[model samples]
Structure formats: C-alpha cells, structure tokens
Target: MSIEVRSLSKRYGRTWAVRNLSFEVQPGRVTGFLGPNGAGKSTTMRSIVGLDRPTSGEALIGGKRYAQQPAPLREVGTLLDAKSAHRSRRAVDHLRTVAATHGISRARIEEVIGITGLESVATRRAGAFSLGMAQRLGIAVALLGDPHTLILDEPVNGLDPEGVTWIRELLGSLAAEGRTVFLSSHLLAELALVAEQVVIIGRGELIADAPIAALTAETERVRVRTGQLEQLLRLLAADGVQATSLTPDTADIVGLPVDDMARRAAASGIVLLEIAPIHRTLEEAYSELTREAVEYRAGLTEQDAS
Candidate 1:
C-alpha cells in the first residue's frame, strides 16, 4: 500500500495547521515524519487518518481517500495516540471490540495479541497498565485487522530500551513483508536507523522529502587533529575550506573526507595526533535543519516589518 498527500491543507480560522503539504509514502519501507514541536507533524497525521478533515487537497491511500475506502481499518492500521482506547478495558477486550467491527475472527485477535507480546498482560485492564504496555496494546489493536499500511504517531514514547528494540524489529519485518510503514516520532536517532525515507515539515509546509542517505550526506563531517594544525588549516584554507581550531593541536575539519584530509596533511608533512570521521548524529542533523529554518523565519519577519 502507498499514501499520497497532494497539496493537503488544513486550517483553524486564521491559522493554518497544514498548508499545501505533499509527499508520498512508498510501500515496503519506513517513512519517517519529522519536525520540531508545533511543526504540524501531529496535525498532518491526524488529517491523513481522517481524524481531522483537511481544508483542501487529500490524503489518499492506494488512490482512494481514507473515508472513501470500503473498510478503512482493513486498509490502514493507525496508532494515532495512546489515549484513543478505553482505559478501563482489558487489552484483549479492546482488540476484540475492534475485531468485531470488522467481523474478524477471535483466533486472529489472539494471534496479534501474542505477536505484540501483550499475552502476559492480555487480561490486565488498560487503566492499570504501564505506558509501555499500553503502547504495545495500541500496536496490537492496529494489527488486529491485518492492514497493509501502518501509521504510528510517537509510538516509542515511554518505552524501555528493550521495548523500543522490539518495536523497531517489528516495524522492519513488517516493511520487509511489503507493507507501508509511516511513523512519526521525536526519536530521530531510531528513525535514522529504521527509516529509508523522511518527510520533514515545519509551520504547516513541507520542508524536505528525501531519502535518509541524502538528508544525512552532509552529516559526514571529519575532524583532523595534527601537530602542524596551523599549517594544515592554511593548506585547507587555500581550497576555500573553513577549518576551526578546537585546541592548540586540534583542528576540526568538516566539508571533506578523512582520507582527503589525511592526504592533504601528509603532503604538508603535518604529523597527525588523531584523524577520524566525526559523523553528525541524527540529533545534530535535525537540530541543524530546524535551526536554519528558525533563522530564516526570523529574517522573513524582520523583512516584512521593515
């Protein structure tokens, strides 16, 4: 299954929650939806699942709108928020009710319950369950109907390291089976590891929609520490490379590969203390993108006033 959001826009009076945002989530891959807080991530997801109507445009699943689908649950399994289910109901019972809606068998429900590792607390009331347990239960409910597309919003919240790992594996396997896995979370590090593509939004507009490798290509920054740090800096500077000195003997060089830096250093007889590639973490990449946007927005505001 695939999702195509075409010029989707949603508004609340004078404020636009999402504005002409467009992207596609391909089947058999995990597409990460990312942005800062209040960046329309949740709003775009809610609109996609038909929880909220878009002011214009459409979020289509496999060529049909979500509402137009004969059986939405059978086509798309969504875990929008942990608070969507009844807190007092047992996890199994919660899934049963959903299964009943689709005329699904009880045996299938049990299978999903076990698959999500909810069998241990299958009978426990959700109100008393831990947040991680509740998240698992939520996932079980999403999987009940055996939908081809899974849309999860902040699914890793409150999960332990083990639980997080389990969820990650489950999603990867699902995608490997040719299902569409579109998920949103603040956990950029985990997303970087799992997602093949990313759709980043900010202030109701799509900022970037690209493969993980492309978005992270700039993240391959290398730092070189050498005895002749000043000489190495001057050598690299001739090529218009900006090198920053962190210490008397340490100069952090970015925008170039470690091997190239080493070659340049050796050509100048610059003895090295340490030369290693410093990959910018996912956190750093995300922060850099959002920070640049913030500065751009600030400049726009100033220009408008002037």
Candidate 2:
C-alpha cells in the first residue's frame, strides 16, 4: 500500500490550514511526517483519513481516494488521535465496537489486544488509562484488521521510554513485513532513528520530500574548531569563510571543507588542535526548517529593539 498526497489544500473560514501539499509515502518503509506545531500536520492527517474534507486537491491510499475505498479500516488503519474513544468505554469494548462495524471477529480483537500488550487493561475503561495505555489501545484498534497501511499522528507524544521503544520496534517490524507505515511525530531523534524517508510540511505547504540521508546531507552545516584561533580566523576570512569564536584558543569555522581547512592550517604553521566537522542532528534540522513557519515568531520585536 502507498499514500499519495497531491496538492492537498484545506481551509477553515479565513484560515488556510494546508496549502498545495504534495508527497508520496511508499510501501515497506516508515516515512516520518514532520512539522512544527500549527504546521498543519494534524489537519493533513485528518484529511487523509476522511475525518476532515480538503478544500481542494486529493489524498489517495493505494491509488484510490480514502472515500472510495470499501472496507477502509481493513485496508488503511489510522490513528489520528489517541483520545477519540469514549472515556467510559472499556479498552476491549472500544476495539470491539470498531471491529463490529467491520464485522471483525472476536479472535482478531484478542490478537490485536495481545499485540499491543493491552491484555492487562483489556477490560479497563479508557478514562482511567494512562496516555500511553490509550495510545496502545488506539493502535490496537488500528491493527485489528491487519491493514496494509498505517497512519499515525503524534503517536509517541505521551508514551514513556519503554512505550516509545516498543512502538519503534513494532513499526520497524511492520515495515519489514512490507507494510506502509507513516508516522507523524515531534520526536525528531526517534524519527531519525526509525524513518527511512521524510515528508516535511510548513504552514500546510510541502517543504521537502526526500530520503532521510539525502535531506540530512543537503542541510548539513559542518562545525569546525581550531586552536590558532586568531591566525585561523584571518586565513578563513581571506577565503570568505565565517568563523565564530567560542574561546581565545578555539573557534568554530564553517563554509569550508575539512581537507581544505587542514591544508590551510598546515601551510600557516597553525597546528590545529581540533578540526572536527559537526553534522546537524535531526532535531536541529527540523527546528531550522519549521522556525520560519511558526504561527508567531517569539521574541521578534524584542530582539529588534535590542
């Protein structure tokens, strides 16, 4: 199964949520859906699941629109929100109700309960369950029909460390089984670890669609440090490279390759104490991408006044 979003746009009154977004989530891998809060991540997920209508454009699963799919729950399992179930409904009962709608059997329900490790609280009502437990229950419901594709929105938001690891393994295994797994998360570190590809959005517009490795490579801003700070800065300045001084003896240099820096240092007899190149962390890359798209940029005028 695959998910394809083609110029998907949505609006609420005067507020344009998502704008001409487009991307493809191929089968057999975990694709991270990334954006800052109010970047339309949730709204996009909702539109894909038909929980909300797109003002224009289309979202398709397996080459068919979600609305046109018969037995959508069986083909495309979605967890748009963890708290969609009734507070008073038992964990098992909640799944069973969704199952009943699809005429799924009791045996399948039990299987999903076990898969999600909800056996202990299978009979407990949702109101008393922890956020992690509710997340698991929601996942159980999604997996009840053994869907070929899964879409999760902020799935690891409230999970404990253990729960996070569990979900990681679960998603990895599902992808290994050749299922399409689309995960939307704010946990950039975790996403970097697990996702093979990423789709980035900002203010409902698609920002990037690429493999994780490629995106990281394209955005990599290397950090360099040298001991002969004054001499190094002068040399780099002549080459038009900007360097930030961290200490009298150490400076972080950028805009030049490591090999070039080493040669230059050696020529100047400026024995480099440290010439390390720093790669951008997933968190750093995500922060940089979405900072401009934030609903309101904090400290903007204050910084200007200063």
Candidate 3:
C-alpha cells in the first residue's frame, strides 16, 4: 500500500494548519515525516486517517480515501497518540475491543501483544500504566489488525533503549514485507538510521521530499590534520578545494572524499596525521531547511539548556 497526500490543506477558521502539502510515501520502505513543533505534522497525519476534515485537497491510501475503505483497520493502522486507549480498560481488553470491531481473532490479539512486548503488562489497567507501557499498548493496537500501511506519530515517545531498538527492527522488517510505514519522530538520528526517504514540511508547506542521502549530500565535509599545514594548504589551494581551518594544523574541507584527500596529500608530500570524512547529520540538514520557516526561535538561557 502507498500513502498519497495531494495538495492537502486544512484550516481552522482564520488560520491554516496545513496548506498545499503534497507528497507520496511508497511501499516497501520506511518514509519519515519530519517537521518542527507547530509544523502541521500531526494535522496532516490526522487528515490522512480521516480524523480531521481537510478544507481543500485530499489524502489517500491505495488511491482511496481512508473513509472509503470498507475495513479501514485491516488496511491502515495508526498510532496518533499513545494515550488513545480507554483509561480504565486493561491493555489486553483495549486490543480485544479494537480487534473485535474488525472481526480480528483472539490469536491475532495475542500475537500483537507479543509483537509489541506488552505480554507482561497485558492485564494491567491502561490508566495505571507508565508512559512507556502505554506506548507499547498503542503500538500493539496498531499491529492488531495486520494492516498493510502504518501511520505512527512519535512512536518512541517514552520507550527505553531496548524498546527503541525493538521498534526500529520491527518497522524495518515490516517495510521489508512491502508494507508502507509512514513514521513521524523527533529523534533525528534514529530516523536517519531507519528511514530511507523523508518528507519534510515547514509552516504547513512542503519543504523537501527526498532521500536522506540527497538532502545531506551537499553538506558532506572532511576533517584533516597535517603536520605540514602550509604545504597541505598550498596543495589544496592549487587543486581549488574549499578548506576552512578549524585549528592551527587542522581544517574542514567541503565535499572532499577522504580517500581522494589522502591520496592527493600523499602525492604532494603532505604528511597527514588524520584524514576522515565528517558526514553531516540529518538534524543538521533539517535545521538548515526549516530555519526560515520556524515559527518561533528559542533563545538559550542559563536556566534553559543547563
């Protein structure tokens, strides 16, 4: 299954939450949905699941709107919020209820419980569960129907390290099975590891829709340390390589391959103590893309980032 968001726009009276956003999430891959706070990511996901009405355009799953599917759960599984389950209901009961509505069997419910690592807390009341447990239950609910497509928002909100690793593997395996997994997460490093492509939105507009590598390709940099700094600089300057000095003997070269630099410096008699490629992080790329579109720029304080 694939998710298609075509010019999807949603307005709340005088303000537009999402405007003219369009992107396609293909099957057989995990596509990340990323944006800053108040960037309309939640609104867009809700609209895709039919939880919010779009003022203009539409969102589709497998070429049909979410409401058009006769068995929606069987086609699309969503984890919009970890606290979506009934407060007083047992975790197992919550799964059973959702499963029952879709004619899902008891065996499948048990399977999902195991899949989400919720077996130990299955009988616990949801209201009494901790945040991490609730996140597991929410994921269990999403997996109960064995849906072809999953739409999750901040699925790792309160998970421990082990849980985080588990979910990463699960999502990767699901995508390998040709399922469409549209995930939104604030953890950029984790997303970079799991997602092959990303759809970035900013202030209700589409900023980027590309492979992770493509987005960060221009940010490729290489770090170098040479005892003969002047000799290395002259050689690099002769080659027209853009290098920014980081220290008296070290520099950061833009878009230079480590092997190429090492080979060139060796040929030029520039003894390099260290030569390594410093790949740009996804967070760095995202920061550059959304800088102009950010609604609020927070200033650091002694009480803030301490």
Candidate 4:
C-alpha cells in the first residue's frame, strides 16, 4: 500500500494548518515525516487517516480515501496518541475491545500483544502502566488488525533505550515484509538510522521530500588541521573555499574537497596533521531546513542574560 497526499490543505477559521502540501510515501519502505512544532505534521497525518477532513485537496491510500475503504482498520493501522485507550481498562481488554470492533479474533489480539512486547502487562490496568508500557499497548492496538500500512506519530516518545531499539528493528522488519511504514518523530538521529526517505514540512508547507542520503549529500564538509593555519587560510581564500577555524591548527572547510586541501597544503609547505571529510548528520540538515520556518524561537535564559 502507498500513501499519497495531493495538494492537501486544512484550515481552522483563518489559519491554515496544512497548505498545499503534497507527497507520496511508497510501499515496502520506512518514510520519516519531520517538522518543528506547529508545522502541520499532525494535521497532515490526521487528514491522511480521515480523522480530520481536509478543507481542500485529498489524502489517498492505495488510490482511495481512508474513509472509502470498507474495512479501514484492516487496511491502515494508526497510532496517533499513546493515551487513546480507556485508563481503567486492562491492556488485554483494551486490545480485545478494539479487535472486536473489527471482527478480529482473540488469537490476533494475543499475537499483536506478543509483537509489541506487552505480555507482561497484558492483565494490568492501563492506568497503572508507565509511559513506555502505554506506548507498547498503543502499538499493540495498532497491530491487532494486521494492516498493510502503519502510521505512527512520535512512536518513540517516552520509550526507554531498549524500547527505542526494539521499535527501530520492528519497523525495519515490517517494511521488509512489504508493509508501508510512515512515522513522525523528533529523534532525528534515530529517524536517520531507520528511514530510507524523508518528508520535511515547515510552517504548513512542504519544504523537502527526498531520499535521506540525497539531503545529507548536499552539505558535505571537510575538516583539516595544519601547522601553518594562516598560510593555508590564505591559499584556501584564493580558491574561493569557505573555511571556519575550529582551533589554532584546525579549520572546517566547506565547498572544497579534502584532496584539494591536501594538495594546497603540500604546495604551500604547510605540515598537514589531519584532512578528512565531515559527513553532515541528519540533525544538522534538519536544523538548516527548518531554521527560518520554526514557529517558536527560544531566547536566552535568565542565567545567560545575567
């Protein structure tokens, strides 16, 4: 199954939560959805699953709207909120109730409980569960229908390190099994580790939709260390290369290759200690993309001001 958002827009009175946003999430791969707070990520996701009706445009799953499907839960599983279940209900009863709504069997409910690692807490009331346990129960609910597409919003929130690793591996396995996995998470490093492609939105608009490798490849930097830093800087300046000094002997070079930097050093008689490429991480790339689009900017704290 594939997810397609075509010029989707949603409005609340005068404000547009999502505006003219469009993207396609292909099957058999994990696609990461990323944006800052109030960037309309949740709104777009709600529109996709028919939880929020779009003011304009459409969100499609397998070439049809979510509500158009006869068996919606069987086609798409969603974890929009971890605290969506009744607090007083036992974990097993919660999942069983959800399954019963879709005519799912108890065997399937147990299968998903095992899949989500919720067996130890299955009989425990949801109110007594910790945040991680609640997240597991939410995932168990989502998986109970054996859906073809899984949409998870902040799935890693409140998870422990072990639970984080488990979710990462589970998502990979699900994608390998030919299921479409679309997730939104603030943990950019974790998303980079699991997702092959990414869709970045900013201020209710589409900023970037590309493969993760391609986005990171555009901002490669090279770090170099040489004894004759001033001479190296002068030489690099002549070649129109941008460099920022990190230390007296080391500088980060942009718009130039490590091989060229080494060649320049050798010709200038500068003793080179280190010359290596600095791969741009996903966090850095995301920061650059959303810098101007961030809705809220934090100012200096009182201690810093003092």
Per-candidate total of colliding backbone pairs: 0, 0, 0, 0
> Candidate 4 at residue 163, lDDT?
98
List the candidate numbers ranked by lDDT, top first: 4, 3, 2, 1
Per-residue accuracy of model 2 over 146-198 as CA lDDT, tens digit each = 99999998789789998899999999999999999998987889999899999
- What TM-score would each prediction reach against the true structure? 0.90, 0.88, 0.93, 0.93
In terms of lDDT, model 2 sits at 0.85
* Model 1 C-alpha lDDT per residue in residues 89-177, reported as the tens digit of each score: 88888998999988989999989988888888999888888888888888988898899999998899889999989999999999999
Q: Lowest summed lDDT over 10 consecutive residues: which window, candidate 1? A: 297-306
lDDT of 3 at 217: 76
lDDT of 4 by residue, 212-305 (tens): 9988886458888878888888988987888899999988989777787788789879898888899989898999999988876677232200
Candidate 2, residue 208: the lDDT equals: 80
What value does the lDDT take at residue 125 in candidate 1?
A: 87
Distance (Å) between predicted and true CA of 147, model 1? 1.0
What ranges in model 1 sit over 4 Å off? Answer: 292-306
Residue 189, candidate 4: Cα error in Å is: 1.1
lDDT of 3: 0.89
Q: In model 3, what are the clashing residue pairs, if there are any?
A: none
Q: List model 3 lDDT by residue over 39-127, tens digit each.
A: 89999999999999999999999999999999998999999889988899999999989998999999999999999888888998999
Decide which is better by lDDT, 2 or 3: 3
